[model samples]
Target: MSDFIGDWYALLVLLLAGFLPNEVWRMLGLWLGGGVDEESELLVWVRAVATAILAGVIAQILVLPPGALASIPPSLRYGAVAVGLMVFIVAKRSILAGVICGELVMLIGKWWLG
Candidate 1:
């Protein structure tokens, strides 16, 4: 414990390194955007870009899933997306419900098709 504590510089470096990566951006945002308007054009553009990034990530995972997901049938994947979309529409675009239904479809598919 004494030896470990003696490495204070290393611990400080580790703490700074870990905190600086993502937290710095968040801190900078708070500093620079003290009075950000939700309906502002720039904010709207940011939201659009964020949504695009989220959609792109989802699409990438669905299209080229790794490991176990890769073994799942393509038909299963398509059907899951269809069911999710339907649920999303019917549920008035509840993303949570849509994702749950999609995941449920995939889970059922794996079990039934096994």
Candidate 2:
């Protein structure tokens, strides 16, 4: 605990690094939101960009994860996602059901494969 406290600066640096990009986007949204209409081209562009960034992040996590997930096959990762989406759709788009099903599928796949 003392060692962890002594490394507070490192933690602060990491937290800032992780936060700055999202903070910039949040600030941008606030700045633009008051004047922009939902159907406007600028808003559409922003939405597209945000969606692309989110998709890229998810893709990277599933395809090139670090730690334990890195050991799992890509097919299993994607299969879990597909099953999760199916569960989400079948469960009236409940995010909790989707996430739980996806994680459970992944865990089962990992165990079976291992």
Candidate 3:
């Protein structure tokens, strides 16, 4: 603890500056959404908007990723996404399955390509 001041400070900053703020909003959302009907039009619209935003972000990442992700070929990235989607559907919309499969695909593709 005494020797790793920088690492501890970074962790503290991450918890205070990032995790706490996100957690507050998440808790607020949970409270606010507690009474909202799942079938309500507003909820549906919000879900759609959130999905669209996520899709857009994913598209942007695939198209023009920053850092090391950009070094991977576009084909590999797109192929991973496709495989992930397939796994997602085949696995009964399991997000964990989709993400794990997608990451595995990306890693294998990168290794194979290299």
Q: In TM-score terms, which candidate is top? A: 2
Cα distance off (Å), candidate 1, residue 92: 4.7
Those runs of model 1 whose alpha carbons end farther than 4 Å from true positions after fitting are: 1-21, 92-97
Whole-model lDDT values for every prediction = 0.89, 0.89, 0.91
Over the stretch 8-84, how does candidate 2's per-residue lDDT look in tens digits? 77878877987886798789879877776779898799789989999999999988898988888899889999999
Select the stronger candidate by TM-score from 1 and 3: 1
Name the candidate, 1 or 2, with the larger TM-score value.
Answer: 2
- Per-residue lDDT value at 110 in model 2: 90
Candidate 3 residue runs with Cα over 4 Å from true position: 1-43
lDDT tens digits, residues 44-108, model 3?
A: 99889989999999899899999999899999999999999999999999999999999999999
TM-score to native of every candidate shown:
0.66, 0.75, 0.60
lDDT string, candidate 1, 1-114, tens digits? 887687778878877987777698799788988577768998889889999999999888878987888999888998999999999999999999999999999999989999
Query: What's model 3's lDDT at 108?
Result: 92
In candidate 2, how many Å is residue 81 off? 1.0
